[model samples]
Target: MTAIEIRNLSKSFGAVRAVDDVSFTVEAGTVTGYLGPNGAGKTTTLRSLLGLVTPDSGEALVNGRRYASLDHPLNEVGAVLEATSFHPGRTARDHLRIMTTAAGLPASRPDEALDQVGLADAARKRVGGFSLGMRQRLALAGALLGQPKIFILDEPANGLDPAGIQWLRGFLRHLAHDTGAAVLVSSHVLAEVEQTVDNVVIIAKGRLVRQGTLAELTGNGGGAVRVKTKDDFAPALRAAGAEVEEVEPGLLRVKGLDAEEIGRLALDQRVLLTEVTHERSDLQSVFLELTAEGERA
Candidate 1:
């Protein structure tokens, strides 16, 4: 199912365009990473989808309907757009209980949500004493109170330690792949995003630059190959219409061809192959290349 869709979405402040003709979709049963450098209109696009910002043009739809038009928004969508605020004096469980009351959810939901986010042991602790990571979990617990099918979280790993980050990666995958939810996460952590998400949508200078699976975006889908051979194959590979880059003394990064094709070429050229590996494009490198223009803008 197409859980979230932004079609030609554009938004702007008084003098600056925040999003420009951006379009993308998040399907159910997958995690989609929403990524961009700073001031690249990522937040604006997300805000538009959540109905938090009024766009200049285009539509942001959740389940084919605007957020405001949903019959039961809370039952369909859960969001953590920014840093969550808490009353320092209130305990974690109490905070969620208040949300449940406001949302007309069951009283037991608070405990259930707390447990789901691994906060049951700290349920009675005051918010004032909670660490940043713990507070992040508390915010997530509140979002879970509704048991929604779609989640929209911005920088969800901001305060997590290495272990917490790893746990979150697994948790999100479980939500999307196992529980059949659509998870859209906006974050600057390319490494984690590369490891966690099933698909990616990248924007720059208020425009959509790329959207695809990691393999697709990284050109690892039969697009690049790394080969090591005794013979100097750079000239021959280039003549064969491959873009060859000698990354090191004996290592060649070949594009416009796959490993199988490269191996065949080596055989034809009588080059003894020591290695023929398909190279996955690095997310960090791709991100930098795509957004370099936006960074200067």
Candidate 2:
């Protein structure tokens, strides 16, 4: 079920290494968030997978073959790399027309794609008139024109409102669940991508920090621990070998303590406990931690 694979893949711009020895696998029927900050070589890596940028060393493969080796590349892997990849003056249908024709899909299939992205109502409108969110949808429609089985989408939710993001999440989930397509949704939006993705591929300075299921990555990730207690609990928590830092008037950040242990200790101390919820490590904290780790190394 592995749909895309990058093995020791690397790319550089003269002396600057944009992507360095990156490797990961994306499986079908899953939505993986390829996450990193700016200039993390995320875009370069995706480009390499699509054969838009040749890796300086190693290989980038799609469905057991390099993108260039695929019998019909568009049908195997569809990509929307960035904004403004569309023709400004052409209608959405016309824009997809060129792409479908290149993919050897029926020119008439553009309508199907347009409809899939909910752009059917605006099919006749010039691309120049579309908002940034609309243009993103159109680009995705273009990528899907051939009914591709894999999607490589970069910053797909940028410029989208809450509703648009919801629509995209549901659409992507549907693509994986219904058609069994594998989706790689790249983004730096922590909370949003954190909610949408099933697994994660995190990179920093062209090096991967972690790649795994959401539970595996965040379940035990160290971050602030939420605690509720009377004011006296602070001193008691410190006595329990946990470094308790007041996060707010009522909440505390207890280091070296998991939520269950903290709760048990609080109960042992006969402290009144009204609420206890562990603050799960979010994408932002994970990114900062990984990036800093890379820097220190």
Candidate 3:
């Protein structure tokens, strides 16, 4: 079953429509990337889902009910929208202890959550002494305190170094794979999301422009066959109904045909081929093209 659902959701701030008829679903046991340019209404949509902002039309549902209708909402959904606030003088353990107590969870949960995020060793250190990466981890630890079934994180990798980002990628995958959690992560880091998420939901001007698995979205754009031959085969390949572009000396990028087809055409044209391979379009380029098109429209 779908863990999170937004149906025809629209929100406005005076004369500005932040989100307009946006709709999407996040399923269990998978990570879905929520992506959009600045001012595209991603934050507004998430805030509406968490009941921090009410939508003007439609609804945001968590497990078939509105977030406000849920019993023990914290235990059902965990969110890390921004760097969590904490008393600078308080130790990490103390901060978590307060949250654990408020959530009515066992005292041991704080320690477990800390260890899960690799912050166990810093439990006794004051929050003021921590770096940005450490604070990001602490916020994530707090989100996991309830062992919630769904995780909604906005820019969770903010302030994380390369190593920290890598760790988060694996941790998020583990949560969805082993624990059957539904994760919706919003970020402007397209490359990281391209590698980490199973599916993607892209928005522009507060409307959903695309939503599908990585393969579905990327693969549909078609692939190009790169070939290197001793002799130029661009003319022959073009005559065979393939779009050919000379990438560099002795190299050609062929579209509307696969590597095998390219090879067969080269052989028929008596071209001595040295290399042939297929390359898929990168997600970053695709994302830019999509958003740019939306802007023009």
Off-target runs (Cα >4 Å) in candidate 1 are 220-224, 232-235, 238-250, 254-261, 293-297
lDDT of 3 at 9: 99
Q: Candidate 3, TM-score vs. the true structure?
A: 0.89
Which ten contiguous residues of candidate 2 have the minimum total lDDT?
223-232
The CA lDDT of each predicted structure is: 0.87, 0.84, 0.87
Global CA lDDT of candidate 3, please? 0.87
| Model 1, position 220: C-alpha lDDT score | 40
The superposed Cα distance between candidate 2 and the true structure at residue 204, in angstroms, equals: 1.7
Compose the digit string of candidate 2's lDDT tens values, residues 69-103: 77788778878878787778888888888877777
Q: TM-scores for all candidates?
A: 0.90, 0.87, 0.89
lDDT of 1 by residue, 1-297 (tens): 589999999998988988999999999999999998778898888889989898899999999999988767778998876655899999999998888887788899999999999999999999999998998898888878899999998888889899988988998998899999999999876886788899999888898888899878787443678888768899989999999899998989898878888888888999888998877658888887777755665
- The number of the candidate with the highest lDDT is 3
